[model samples]
Target: MAEWALIFKTAIALFAIVNPIGVIPIFISATDGWPAKDRAHTANTVAITVFIVLTVSALLGESILEFFSISIPSFQVGGGILVMLIAISMMHGKQSTTRQTPEEAQETAERNVIAVVPLSIPLLAGPGAISSMIITAQQSGSFWGHISLALPIAVVCLAIWLALRLSMHIAQRLGTIGINVVTRLMGLILAAMAVEFIAHGISGLFPSLAS
Candidate 1:
């Protein structure tokens, strides 16, 4: 039960950070000229890419950081800052430059194939989402925990797939203002999570100060 709860919380955090609703416009623009079947294929491809990227981050990201002699506390601080920057951008009703710059978005629209580039790579599974997963995996600390984390990662990917598959309807229903509202709310939640990450990192780095 506790494991499932953790998975649920992780899913919520990841979903908020990924915020496919915020990326709908970008996806729409990127797939503008494609037929419906092609658009669906793109959505499926992007979701699969997201799943692979985030699953790898959850399972192996910590080991990679350790291999480079990077400590988790330092990572937390840096990752938190990155997530905060994304949150701030969302608050301003814009996509984070860290994730996908306007130039990248423009370039994405001109690309022949975009599922792997802007959509899945940075837009859906960017630094913020990767960092969040790494931190969550670290907290889990067991084989079962890692397995549990994988479930939520899959759920997040599924949610992304559904959102992209229904992009037109969602965009029309939500409109620009509604999307902005959701973006702002998700940003607020992400900002709070970022602060928590920074706090935990600081406490770990300076135990004496914590006392």
Candidate 2:
């Protein structure tokens, strides 16, 4: 039951951070003027790319931290700050430069193959998302625990794909104001999660505070 609870928490956190609904506008813009088939293909590619990137991060992130001698607590704090920044940006109804800079956005417009580059890499599976997964992976110590993280990752990716697949309909239905409202709501949730991450990290670093 506890494990299932943890998985549910992880899924919610990932969904809030990823915020596929929030990315619908960007997805629409990127695939603008493309054929329906090509657009669908881009959506599929983005989903697959995000799943692979996050899943790999979950498995290898701890080793990478160890290699650099960066403790999980330190990473948690740093990652928490990063996530908080993203949350603030989302609340403002703007995409974070941390996820993709103005240059990348321009490049995305100029490029034809944007599914993996700006869309999946930074736009969806950005540093904040990666860091969150790493932190969760570290907490899940067992092999099965680590592997189970994939389930949520897969679910999130599926959501991403579905959002992108129906991007046009969503954009038309939600409009700008509606989308912004959703983004702000997700941002609020993400901000709370970020606080938790920061608090937990601080407690880990300073055990005395935990008491």
lDDT of 1 by residue, 78-192 (tens): 9889999998998998888898778887777677668999889888899999999998888788977986788998888998999999999999999999999999999988899
- Please give the CA lDDT of all the candidate structures: 0.89, 0.93
- lDDT tens readout by residue for model 2, 90-202: 99999888998888777777776799888888989999999999999988889899999999999999999999999999999999999999999989999998998899899
Best by TM-score: 2
Clashing pairs in 2: none
Q: How many backbone clashes are present in model 2?
A: 0
RMSD (Cα, Å) for all candidates, in order, is: 1.5, 1.1
Pull out the clashing pairs in model 1: none
* TM-score quality measure for candidate 2: 0.96
Q: In lDDT terms, which candidate is top?
A: 2
Give per-residue lDDT, candidate 2, residue 144.
94
